[model samples]
Target: MDWGLVGILLLMGAGGGFAAGLLGIGGGMVLVPFITMIFTAKGFPPQVVVHMAIATSLATIMFTSLSSVRAHHKHGAVQWRIVALLAPGIVVGSWIGPWIGKQMNTSALSLLFAAFVTFSALQMILNKKPAPGRELPGTPGMFAAGGVIGVVAGLVGAGGGFISVPFMTWCNVRIHQAVATSAALGFPIALSGTLSNIYFGWSEPGLPQYSLGFIYTPALAVIVAASVTMAPLGARTAHKMDVVSLKRAFAVVLFGLAAYMFYHAFA
Candidate 1:
């Protein structure tokens, strides 16, 4: 592997992982576009470049989520009950997402991803709270919500935190608990999504070397190494910082990324 490529991957991973821990995100919002650009520069076929970037981002999330969850768990912030309720539907929905994504046009998928990112960023900027008396739904409702979160996350290669955290908070869960629980949910989302991507793309042609299905293994390896190490530090930072301000700052960054992605889709 080119050392320069490795360096870039490591940098992306570190940034993504830190965001994951700090914002209760899986970091795919950051990873997907950057990785797509890197793969494009490497001359990968445009049709498959986004797919590969999403797949690799999901794969990396498996590790980053684990690391972030561990940190959250240490603080007794994770709500395991919610995770248990969400896992079944999340797995099924995640499995189906890649199959659907594989049939979409590359530019369409990129635009969709950009839109999702922009929406999530706006949510952070607004920081809206739900009704004071709201509460979590029963098992069936939680499962359905998980399904929606999983499908969207799988398509975007995210950890589902953007959706999950908000959903939990709307149900009157505390912000820290919602964030922690969302970190735990990332495990199932990433795992199921990665597996589906691997299966769906197993027969695709023109994938780059060192790839396993849609996942680019070299980038995955380098990114995972840096991300896992940095996740705990981010979690620690999250505990100490003013998350609301941090989120607004992150929203500005997301807006920039969204603009870039929009240009890429149309230009």
Candidate 2:
């Protein structure tokens, strides 16, 4: 194990986790690109590096999501009903996501990730509101929406907060409630997505040492350690300040990450 690399991963985890807690995301959006760069620097196979990064990102989220949710729940902000309604469809969609991802080549997946990140960033920057008096969908509609969120989140290793928060807020949920609920939703998204990635990549060739399927266990361990510890802090911070400005700042960061991914995709 390279201690230096481990240090870098720890730093990445801290940053990602803080962002996750603050934003109600699972931190996968921050972890994926940085982990990819790390793996690439270590000369992991280009074809599999992105997959490994995403898988590990999801794995880390399993812990970070739990930590964030615990903090949010303490504040009584989580909407358990919404989580229950969305989980089933999320599981199904997450299960299918890795299979579809595995079918694509590295460049394609990178481009897709870039596009997704760019869209999320733009949405944040625009801060658009739904038409007046818009409400959340019915149970069946929510299920379908969950499925879409799951598929896209699984493919990109995100916790689905970007979609879920907006959806909830549009339906008249308070911003705090929406953010907290999104944190709750991250659990199923990360769990199902991580399992799918592991199953999909179990027999793939050219994996790095210390990897289980597409997840690099060493990095996962280091990242989880840092991220879990920092997530609560982020949740606390989110409760204390104006998150709207933070969201815009986060959008700028996402745009930079999108550009990074785009560069890597076509390089």
Best candidate (score: lDDT): 1
Model 1 lDDT per residue over 133-178, tens place: 7788998998899999999999999998888987898888898888
| Residue range with the least summed lDDT across 10 consecutive positions in model 2 | 127-136
Clash number for each model: 0, 0
For model 1, the local distance difference test gives 0.90
What TM-score does each of the candidates earn?
Answer: 0.98, 0.96
Whole-model alpha-carbon lDDT for candidate 2 = 0.88
Model 1 alpha-carbon miss at residue 160, Å: 0.9
Question: Pick by TM-score: which candidate is best?
Answer: 1
* Over 4 Å off, model 1: none
Any residue pairs clashing in model 1, and if so which? Answer: none
